[model samples]
Target: MVARDAQDNVSPRSSTTTVTTGAACGNPVCGVRQVTTDTDIPWGLVTLPDGSVLYNRRDAHDIIQLNPTTGVKTNLGTVPNVQSTDGEGGLLGLAISASFSSDRWLYIMHTSPSDNRVVRIRLENGRLNTASEQVLVSGIRRNKYHDGGRLRFGPDGKLYASTGDAQNGAYAQDRSALEGKVLRLNPDGTVPSDNPFGNYVWSYGHRNPQGLTFDSQGRLWEQEFGNSIMDETNLITRGGNYGWPACEGTSGTCGTAGFIAPVRTYPTAEGSCSGITIVRDALYVACARGARMYRAAISGSSLTNVQTYFSGTYGRLRTVEPAPDGGLWLTTTNQGDKDSTPNNSNERVLHVTLGN
Candidate 1:
């Protein structure tokens, strides 16, 4: 089967017919290989137990199933009422239920006409039943930019979603509002009983958090986009406040006001970290502006042995997901223009193997 470009306008490139490995990072030769080329602005990715890889395109507003080994894609269908407006806001995140085989349910986080929302859809016989869409959570503030869109199921069996400040900095400090916060919810969209605020708000004071994942110790870790100065990787805690407008990185009055400090920070020029994933004991973060993937050794909640791979090789890495084949699958956001690799063959997905 041939691969299709983002617009589905061109045929598959002959050069991508075979998997080619690049350089070595460690003992066994860590390398990156192209899986599928010419994808639209692919945002989120989730792999099922059956090795079915699913991802969503921000502008297309559609969830697609990709055959990892064959590079064949099937459009599962579009999420209803998605607003692919200006910067950042659109169909952003996707997550499959733990009981996917039994329930065949999938969840998507998207920017609707009015606000950002999480909706549930059923996949029957490998096709999305869009007519069966169920709105799980709604009313998240939306803007032309800063619509934080990362969703994941936590170790505790709860849905955790990250929301941006929607260009409104004050929303980070407003507990009554869902903007600029990590929200915890049941699969049915109800607030979890043990949530910090007795509502869906899990952790507050964030400025467009885009990465959410759980470590080996079952602790939540998030990567947030900061202003001009710093970008943060934080160990998220229940009821913890990550000082946002009042603070940029770790410089503001963090300790004094009970705000939790980030575990690590990077200059905006070095990293505009987006998606994060844990493979074995290492945490891999995909950076958009940095055009690289960062690998850090994870020992419980602490991170060390930091290094970078594929820097500028696969322009603007957006999302990274663990492949069922013991490798990592990443998506590039090189959709053209100033923020991405110009004149590239659309955005693509790359597979990388981390050598032991």
Candidate 2:
């Protein structure tokens, strides 16, 4: 089920030899088709200007390039000093520079021996220059689980990173700590001059924020995992504190704690959301336990006309990336989930075409 990376590291499992196509269920706006059946726990995906796809496998700890048209996957190289431990810590999010074509700079968030960190590397001529790795940010604590690792570049050209509380609730409330916070940094790893905290910390009091994206208006949106009661989709604001342990969803003493409430909340059973992407004015959220994609109309910070797509059709959806052709590329995490079995075709990236 698992393929090997260029370094011979075990890649993710693929589903079948042939591509599988499926009709849109309930929602008539989009149809889905399996694009590549050759990925194992693909965590992050970013498309290049030339339509090439660069992705990362969580356990594999390597960056891979996939030819969108040919289905050819090339392992660029393994990121140095990555500790892919059990649970959620490992090589996670990947983001290319705004000037990737010229600078060839790429960034990744991963777990190190001590804590989770963000590192910048050079991608030269289709290969990753591992020796060029520069640790941009470090000292964020990590645990066997709850290492929130999602990286994205905001429209302002600043690097935005999400970090989990590492199961330490107090960290979410600690203004001096990096864990359980959203950070804003320059591409070179320095704190932005206008950061609200005078440091990298932007928003705080987040539990496990896995999804981050910018709307057309440049406002940042986040999707987070809740403890047991609820899951959340939030509008991230500068210096906004989202009540984490002090607040489960909208409950608890969040209002008194000056915590920002979520735009929408779902019961944990209905949503263990992971990745998110904005397309055609709708925010598409990928769910793991819910096994569905939730599309909501975005209006400022509020979500309306919330609709569900592919409910239970795909198991444990992970990354939902916008494709070059105005569609979406969705990766599933069924290989090791309790609801599904691992197969050669289990973990797959699906192309989704939205209708009018």
Report how far residue 260 has shifted in candidate 2, in Å: 0.8
Candidate 1, 1-356: lDDT as tens digits = 46543234566556535566865567422777887875468888998766778888787678888888898988888778998556678888899877877787898999999999999999988788988889999999898878899999988889999999999999999998999999999998888888877889999999989999888788899999988989999999999899988888877766666788888898888799899988787888999999988989887667898888888988888898888666888998876412322123288888887787
Candidate 1 clash figure, as a count: 0
lDDT of each prediction vs. the true structure?
0.85, 0.86
Candidate 2 stretches with Cα past 4 Å from truth are 1-28, 337-345
Estimate the TM-score for candidate 1.
0.89
- Local distance difference test, candidate 2: 0.86
The C-alpha local distance difference test score for the whole of candidate 1 amounts to: 0.85
TM-scores for all predictions? 0.89, 0.89
Count of clashing residue pairs in every prediction: 0, 8
Q: Model 1, residue 139: what's the lDDT? A: 96
Give lDDT tens digits, candidate 2, residues 1-356: 67653235787787867766765445424577877875457888999877889988787778889887888889898888988546778889999976887788889999998889999999997788988899999999989878889999999999999999999999998989998899999999999989998889999999999999988998899999999999999999999999888998888886765788899998988899999999878999999989999999998668999998889998889889899778899999876533111122358888898765
- Residue range with the least summed lDDT across 10 consecutive positions in model 1: 336-345
